[model samples]
Structures are given as structure tokens and as C-alpha cells.
Target: MDNQRSLWAAWAERLRQRFSFILQGQCALCDRPTSQVFCQDCTRRLQACRVQSSVLQIAGLPPLYSWGYYEGALKQSLARLKYGGRPQVAEPLGQWLAQVWLDSGLLERGLVVVPIPLHGDRQQQRGYNQAELIARSFCEVTGMPLRARGLIRTQPTTAQYGLLRLERYQNLSNVFQVGAALQKSPNLKDIVLVDDIFTTGATLKSATETLQQSGFRVVALFTAALSERQIA
Candidate 1:
């Protein structure tokens, strides 16, 4: 009976491996055979391309820190996450952002991770807030608490893509407000605003101003990718 059980276990393991190989798909970036969305080699290369600058200065807003520029593998991965219905991509990407946050030494300040919120209609349409997903994963990896509802989007606005710099700011104006729970939480002070991408600093600036007006200090903006123009 013992020998039979051992043989059966071995056979089951073999079958599981075979099935896993069958199910494993190509890497999202390189098209190489990988069980994960991004293979190990591609992931390392992506990490290597990350921005060495830990501080990004934007007028009237907290400094931003991004993992990499929005291009190549990073851009492709984010596009899939945002528009391709591949929400699972947020995990590894968020982990990378979390690592950046950890290395930046701001984690010692007891900062709360707050993701920029999506309006009810838009969020419902998309079925998920990508920022929230990234923030959740960030907290999981860093062991920091995430205040997912710290901010609320009271109104929906036009998408910022292709909009001029001034237009982007105007579009987001009066769009975000502090959530009631965060308002009532007296202990909450410092925050790290998490977003998927930083384009022109408009969205983050608006969110920062709103939070600051509400008596919270935004320590920094954390994002997965930053546009080339914004990098300068």
C-alpha cells in the first residue's frame, strides 16, 4: 500500500507539471515561453531600466518617484493592464514600485499609501481601479497599510490622454475630495499617492492639492512609469 501511494504521488506530480507546461503562455513583452506574464529575464531587464533618480520636482506638488519610463516593456505591460483587461499584471508591477518606495527611505516616516480614486461610473465601467489594485499590491509587499478610500472621486472627467497640459489640470479640478473615513481619522497624517503612470503631473497635482487642503501631507507620488517629458 505504501509503495502504491508513492507511485501515485509521483505520477500526479508528473501530470501536474505536464498540464502546467501546456497552460504556461508566452511572456507579455518578449513572447518567450513563460508561465508568468513577464518572464524572469525580461523582468530583470525592466528593473534595470528603472530611473535612478529618486526625486521628481513638480511645481506646487510633492516630488514624484517612478520605477521606470513609460516605454518598451514597461509601457507594453501597463497598456495591457489598463486596456487589455489584464488586471493580474498589477501584482509584479506594484511589487517593483513597492521596492522603489522601500529604497527611498520614506517608508520610515509611517506614510499611508493612498491611490488616486476613480469615479463611480468610470470604475464601474472598468470593473476595477487600476491604481487601487497597484496600491493594494504595494501594501502587501511592503507591509504598509493602504488607505484605499482615503480619497474619493466625486465627478467623472474626460480622459487626460492627448489633452494639453493646462487642459489636464482643468479637467481634474474639483474632481477629487477627501473621503469621510479619512477625514475622521485624526491619526492619518503623511501619505504616498500611488498611481499607475505619471504623464504631465496634472492628476497627481490635483490630488495632492485636495489632500493638502484637507490637512494631510502628501510625502510623495509613487508610480510605475513616468513619461519622458515629465522626467525632465
Candidate 2:
């Protein structure tokens, strides 16, 4: 039974990979043919908006780094990934983020990458965590170890969109807890929190505080895009 299960799993993975390759050949922004998620024209235009400073400060949280302002082609691509069931969009977006991390001279040899976790019920509904998909791609390009099980969302919260800033913070308060697997490993030091977008810093701050309370040092927050309101 185990051997049969393994065979089935391998076959499933191959199918997933084949589908991803076909998806990759089409530009995510304009639907033009290209070898990456974004075609050459879209890539050039998107790269023009790269954030000048690689690091940003959020009130009472670790320094955050983002690839670019969440607008134009980048914004549409993220929306597709997060809401349109386009998991393949994370690949090129995550590669760009990983390149930014490397360019910032923050690529430590042993730093662990942790994706912001979704509540169990929410993840089941979405079929996958968008942050995890991006983090997996980031790890693949950077060769960094991903520690997704380090943190788990303990409670489901209402969506932060359209909520007041204070409400957003309150919504996420005390919602994250260190996972059992990570609690068993006491040697974890430096960590990078990966997320698809940085809107109000509520989620990252809550997760960072949870890890810190557990004696883990969250070195930084790395995200694909920074919301326009936050950038303003």
C-alpha cells in the first residue's frame, strides 16, 4: 500500500510540474507568450518601480523589505495569485523577491525562512496558503531552508481589507502561536518572515511578537509587494 501511495504521489507531482511549466510560458500580466511569469515588456516596466530603499521601518516591528510598490503589473499579478487560483504566479514573483533579498546583502548563511501561516479552516478553504507558495519558490531560488511549521495561526480572523487600522491590529492580536515541531527545536535563532504583501504590518507584527515571546529572533520581514497606502 505504501509503495502504491508513493507511486501515485510521484505521478501527481509530475502532473503539477507539467501544468506549472505550461502556465509559466504565458505572461501573467498580459497573457503574451514568454518564458517567465511576466513577459519582457512587462518585466521592464515592473522593474522600473523597484523600491529605492531595500529596507523599511514599521512601528514596533522588525525592518521590512519589499520588492516594489504594489501597483501596475505587480499588483495585478498578486491579485491573480491570491484570488484567481494562479499558484504558478508565485514563481517569478518570488524569484524577484529572492533577488532583492540577495541584493540587500541580507542573505545570511543559516537564516531560516518562515511563511506567515493561515488558520487551518482558512487554508482548507483556499486550497493553499499563498505565502507558502511564494516562500517555497523563494527558498528554491535562494537555497535557503524553509521553516513553515515554525508558526501556526491559532485563530481565524476576519479579513483585514476595508478595516480600520486599529481594527486590523485587533483582529490579529494573539492569533499566532509557535508550532509544536518548532517548540521542540530550541536552537532556532534568525528567521525571515515571508508574506505575499505588506499592508498594515499587523500580521507580521503579531507573528513576530509570538516568535519573540518564544525566544526566537525574527530578523526581518520579506514580502513581494508593499501596499500603495503603506508606501504613501
Candidate 3:
């Protein structure tokens, strides 16, 4: 039985290798023949965005930790993953994000990773929640268990594309809702809200307020990057 299992495992590994080579022809950014989803050149070019990993607590809002400003290759990558329905993109990018947190010596004590939940309708429309994918990958890399329950968007929100700055905040003010099944061993007494981007900090603020009201002491907000379209 063990011998048979090893043979199957080896075959699976070979299959995966072949599949990867088949799927990956050229770097999306540089058109290089690299195993990396994004070529090394593109990865290095994305380093222009760097923000302090330390905590920044907002009044009446949870402490926020933005990886950096979203630009260059990051914008393209996120667009591909978010709008283009690319799940594979989350693997490399999310792993890099976890490494950034680990190298920074963050992901502190009593850490819980709660992805910002998408509205059910929106999630269905998108086919998957990009933030959830990143959070799942982050958990796999960090060994931190993920909690996606009880936190949800109560309803669909209007498009934020051209909304005024003030309107954006107002639109998301009461968008999220705490799930009734907030009961769990690792309840959100201490958690880090995960998301793909932080624009006006409005979404984080709103989610923070809801969690705190539910007595979950949300300590931090972690986003892959910050949105450049933030209202001035």
C-alpha cells in the first residue's frame, strides 16, 4: 500500500509539473520563459511600493497595515485576479505578501486572519472573492487558521467608480454585518481583517466598527495594497 501511494504521489507531482509548464509560456509582464507567474523583472519592479509594516490604529477604527500603494505591475496583477477572474494569480502574489509580513516580523500574537467578506451577490457575480483567495493563501503560508464566518456584507453596494469621496464612505458605512454564528473557539477577540486593497480606509473603518460592536477587538487591517483613487 505504501509503495502504491508513493507511485501515485510521484505521478501527481509529474502531472503538476507538466501542467505548469504547459500553462506557463511567457511572463505576463516581460514575456520571459520563467516558472514564476510573473517574471522576476516584473516582481522587482513592483517593489517601488513600500509602506511601514508597523501598526497604525485609527480612532474608532482598527489598526491598519497596508502593504503598499498599488501601482505598476501590482495594478495589472490585481486587475487580472479581480476583474479577469484569475485565481492562480493569488498563489504567487499572496505568498509574497505572507513573506513580507513574516520578514517584517509581523503577524503578532493572538493573530486571526478574517478576510473582508463580499456580498453574496457580488461574490457570485465575480465567481470568487479575490480577498478571500489571498487570505486563504496567506493562511497556508503563515499556518494561521482562517475565519470567514459570521462576517458578511448584508447587501450589494453601488459601484464606487465615480462616487465622490464623501459618498464612498457613506455608501459603505452600514454595508457589512456581523453573522449570527459568531460563536467559535477562536472568536474574533483579536483578529486582522484581510483585504485586497484599502482606498479611503472607509471599508476597513466600517468593518472595524461592526466587529468591535460585536465585541471582537479587531486589532489590525491588512491589505495587499492601497488604492490610488483615494479621495483627497
Candidate 4:
């Protein structure tokens, strides 16, 4: 049954790829009528966030790069995909990350991209880790190996959205653990940690510690956006 299901999925994915050329649409981040979801201007804006960090970086974490703030159409798009079950949007968003990385020189310093992982229960519920979806797409384009299976959230703690900054850090301190991605990858050091967004920078920080403890020379925290840092 599993093999049959896999065969069907492969066929479906092939169909989607073959028919993708017939697609036409505007940008997801901006409203301009372009083949991609985001127009060139909007793409420029998101790419700019990569070089504009106030502090440049956190210790031992990769630089965070976002396509845009969690506002306007980007926010709604993320909402639809994250909560409304529109997983297809992930492909374009992933492409955005890949584009930003290449244009911004993020890949010049790092070889591996590891997406933040979800706990098994959450994976069962969502049937995906949104981070992994983006990472998989990113890996395909950048020619960088993606460690999608490593670093898991062992505990399902309360959502960090409601917690204060420090509280958010404390809440996630014990949440993530290094997974099989480490055991299997060759030359695992100097990894670029990828996540969808960085709010308090706690989740990525904790995950970095886990990987470092397991001997990875993590460099920076890279993401699609920065949430708490840009408050007015």
C-alpha cells in the first residue's frame, strides 16, 4: 500500500510539474502581474531585509533573511498556507528564499541548509513541517544539500506567540533536539539554519545549541522574515 501510494504521488507530482508551464499569475508578495507570485519590486524589498539587520547577527547563528515583513499580502499568504491548508504556495515562497540566498551571497558561506523541525505529533497533524517544505525547494535550486530530517521539536509546548520575548525563549529552550539529519550527513559543520520566521530568536537559538552540542559548527539563523525586531 505504501509503495502504491508513493507511485501515485510521484505521478501526481510529475503531472503538476509538466502542467506548471501552462500557469500564469501575479506575485504572492506583491500584486504586479508577473509569472511569479511576487513582482520584481517586491522581490527587491524582501531581498533588502537580508542586509538590513540592526545587529547583523546573533552568536553562532546564521544571518536571518526575510522576503518581507509579516504584513500585507505576505502575511495573508502565509496565513492561508499555514492555517488554510494551501501547501502549494510553499513552492513559490521556497523559490523566493532560494533567490534571496543566491542574490544575497548566503550560500557562499554555508553548505547545508537545515530547516527547523516539528514534533512528531505536529507533523502527523499538519502532514508537513512548513519549514521543511521551503527547505526542500531551496535545496533543489541552490544545489545545497538539505538536512530536512534533523533537529526536531521533542515537546509540544504552548504556542510562543502569546509569550513575552524572554518567555518565548524559555518556552522553546527545551523544545528542539538534534535528529537523524546529523547522523547521516557527511561534513555536517557550518550549517545554515533555516526557519520560516524569527520572532524572539529563541527557537533557532535553542536549536543551534542542540546542534552545537552534537558537534555542528552552526553559523547563522536564516529565515523568511523577522517578526519582533521591526516593531514600531
> Which prediction has the highest TM-score against the true structure?
1
Model 3's C-alpha root-mean-square deviation from the true structure amounts to 7.6
Q: Which ten residues in a row have the lowest lDDT in candidate 3?
A: 50-59
Tens-place lDDT per residue, model 3, 1-232, is: 9999999999999999888877777665556777777777877876666554434555666656666678877777788888876677777666766876686666577677788888898899999888888888888998876777657899788876678879888889888877644556444477778888877777778888888877787766778887655312
What is the Cα-based lDDT of residue 181 in candidate 1? Answer: 58
Model 4: lDDT of residue 213: 82
TM-score of each: 0.87, 0.84, 0.79, 0.74
Ranking by TM-score: 1, 2, 3, 4
Q: What RMSD value applies to candidate 2?
A: 10.1
Q: Per-residue alpha-carbon lDDT of model 4 for 1-232, expressed as tens digits?
A: 9999999999999998666645655565544466765568865664454424322455555566666566555666676566766565677678877777777754564468889988788778887788888788777878887888777788987777779978888888777777777777656677878877777778888898888888887765666666745443
* Predicted structure 2: lDDT: 0.86
RMSD per candidate (Å) reads 3.8, 10.1, 7.6, 10.7
Model 1 Cα lDDT, one tens digit per residue, 1-232: 9999999999999999888877897777676778887899988878776886957888887878888988877888888888877787888889989888888877565678899999999888888999999999999999988888999999989999989999998999989999975877769788889999999888898999898898899998999998988766
Quote the lDDT for 217 in model 4.
Answer: 73
Candidate 2 local Cα displacement, residue 61, angstroms:
1.1
Count the clashes in each prediction: 0, 0, 1, 13
Q: Which segments of candidate 2 are over 4 A away from where they belong? A: 1-25
